[model samples]
Target: MRLALPTAVLVTALTACSAAPPAAVTPVQATPSSTPSVTASAMPRASAGAGEGLPAKLRFTQIAQFDKPVAFAVRKGDDAVYIAEQGGRLHAVKGARTTMIVDLSAEVSKGNEQGLLGVAFHPSGKWLYLDWTDAEGTTHVTEWAFDGTTAKQRRDVLTQDQPYANHNGGQLAFGPDGYLYIGLGDGGGGGDPQGNGQKLTTWLGKILRIDPRGEPYVVPEDNPFKDTRGARPEIWAYGLRNPWRFSFDKETGDLWIGDVGQDSWEEVDHEPRGRGGRNYGWNAFEGDRPFDQGVEAEAAVEPVITYQLGEGGSCSVIAGYVYRGTKIPGLRGHFLYGDFCAGWIRAAPVDDPARTVEVGKVEQLSSFGQGNDSELYALSLQGPVYRVDAP
Candidate 1:
């Protein structure tokens, strides 16, 4: 749903609470535990120079404009940036020319959170994928054969019935391992009343890994839950509320997720390469604190970053990428992220997330894009797309 905004900040203090033991194999869990906070004294010091201050001052140059652009993507070795609008039109923005690449407005749902949500290109650049909600509010991850100028031979890869209108986790990326990774939210109701987050049998509230080239899709043989009885074989990780956006560091292959919290807190989760089967406390925890009192969470991994929900008018976290592009030397190895409501962008070193610094801002920020050159771009639901350039 289109979220309402709050005008003020509500400070969030780190709180700890012991949870009752976890139930066997069922969904539901406690809020998570918080990691130790990093002191200001530990942060990288700002300097006056080019590429200075945590990564150098950033200039977001307006590169293109679209109709409610929600996601951006890049094809391998291609200079064009693909923009996906909530209304189901995909456009290729290359230099001064913008071309319509695809249109599915008739098939996409019109809800605030529904519609065309994410787009990605396969590593081979021959395939394009889209994650969107149908008219019935069902999520679909579809694939198409793309030959640069056009897309054809459409096929369905995965489908899930969403229980509610909001919290449709729509993020798709091809990981370093060459497998397609998909993020799904805990089937949308307040606090996961359906208990999908910790439920092994369901794909909801999980990050799934599969080879979309297979018929429909093929679960990787090495998937974390592939051999686990009653578990969805495609599941790589579970226990997430709403993973709005996620990306792999181009250089390190680490996974970074911006999982929107229920209330009070918002978080960014980081998982090192090859660490699958992680449970990021959802109903059980919200940004390192207990959320649902009745649910016992598994050994959950706490988020590396958390902030008050209304801190500086912040609402949902929009996860970006780790800057590895040569255009900004100081930005290399730093993870970039922002908030949907607050519209401010910040960056933290991959090695030390707590040592963060504000870098830029984009009003109505919906998503970020990393190009084939590894440079970054930010999208706004209001239409403008900006390229993050060194100032």
Candidate 2:
């Protein structure tokens, strides 16, 4: 929507998988699920091959296409991949067939980074979670029961009124800790029009943690600002401009965030498992550089890696996943990422041993999805979702 970088060095501002081959999908009556979230089992590592350590030669294969598909997810123990169309429908991509699961078109307003921006299946494989903006420009994190074809039993997990349409950081993921982590951008307009990033009273421009089924959604007691005065306890981390996409490392439990840039620098922020309360310095700074002198940066957690916006056809940085899939021998521990406009698919090792490597490029890359086996798939907003592969 918002026309939406890499490196190494291991500079420590540093704080900070595999599982069943998918069981049959079980439809539920959209009841509130109290079951713990699913954690990925460790995937077997790939043994080195002839091309091991060979210069990378990546290729893209189109698996499927959809209209304005912005987000996707795999069920806890199922192989079918569910895709979210911005106009408000979830589609399933399995083998040779594609089917629509649900439609919320009457409730969604599509335009300018607004719409159904994210989707996720509950750990029990029964419920489906969605993060999207409604026709009134309000953000809603809703849960519905999935019967493999239609969505039912709608439940509202959370909601926030947006001041502007753009910068609605609506990505959602259930962390290894069994809590849902939400990313929200500062209330849109140019440069954080409301200065929401630095304020503790609001959830915008912050990563929030909550239990979706606990008493109409309860904020976790362990959240960073739980006891802080004036700070909304839902905030797990504050001061992100627009963290469009972020995921938890299935094996290591680390959190990876791709925070979109304001003017020049796009950045990647990392946090170790079990750590929070760190400030990422949005208004005070942008991508490790002093930005707004008006507010001094205090104990800010700078990005581990950042790339200039104008480089490599770069525009907005789409923060992607750390490859733990065994299909690509050389991509084992590397964090795969790309840009919306530049279309170049690049990766930096999660361990940061080597500098960022340019893998390959594509057109209009919007999002990246992981299969049940941990393999990586690239979703282009234009239509084709490519499977990133190598010989």
Candidate 3:
């Protein structure tokens, strides 16, 4: 729910304690990223050598549906795919049957961009994590003991007080190094009035890395700002407005982010494996243009791709994964992403991100999930979860 609106509309909605709802979306133009190129031999079989052309046809197959599914996760050695509903219930989908495995209806905050927004499992599959907004609108990243059949013994690993309801970046994932990574938005309000994006003292507008199994949590020494004075030691990257969704390449371990833009642009940022300490300029720069000339950012990383807002109704970028599954050979090496309002899913080759082709669409697209097999699934806020596959 990263939809933008006029100041008058925003104030009215906020006064009612509501977030900006979805609006019509349109097509947008993509700008190529500045990352290095990969050799043709490294590309998947069906795809023409690096940056050459589009891949074969692909389609979405309805695997199952749920009540406003926002995140999908899997447990190691388990055959079921777990979907986290915004209303605070975890559903386990095995073949055609769906079962409620964990319920937190009484615990979650209800509204746009809130609720059980993210779900992930420990690499060992012994722990389940939920990134959710509590009844008071504070974000609580909780850990639960799990035995595949049920989840119990919940404990809070991290908590942050949200300033505004909108722009709560609620996505979680385990990096290739096994550290839990969390995304949080700039304390909401248009134009970053709080100045959190470029501030190091707060966790807002940043990505954090920590070991959650510790008492509460442990900030890894390797984190970029761990020893920096006046900075939150957990921060791995900074200067983001609202990084709603991000993912790591399963094969290359490279990081990709879809940072929802402020007003004019939507962007996708890329960081090579282990390349921390990046400043994805926000409040200071939107897309490639300067937004706030007063704020200074040190060596900001430019977006690999950017699209204009309000063009063909395009709004709210949903960052996805680089396909590495055996089922979609043609999609291998291509990064998949979409817009929440536009509902169109497109894939751009890792080499040339500007040359994108529409792959599929999911109504009310909320997030994308990668399975244990490296396959992908797209979740819709409208209740359908589709598996990416060759038609």
Q: What ranking emerges by lDDT with the best candidate at the front?
A: 1, 3, 2
lDDT of each model, Cα atoms only?
Answer: 0.79, 0.73, 0.79
TM-score of each model, paired residue for residue: 0.87, 0.85, 0.87
Residue by residue across 271-302, what tens digits does model 2's lDDT show?
88989888999888888788788976569887
Clashes of each: 10, 7, 7
lDDT top scorer: 1
lDDT of 2: 0.73
Residue-wise lDDT of candidate 3 within 68-107, one digit each (tens)?
7789898899998898887798888887577888888898
Candidate 1 wrongly placed segments (more than 4 Å) = 1-56
Candidate 1 is scored at a TM of 0.87
The window of 10 residues in a row where model 1 has the poorest summed lDDT is: 5-14
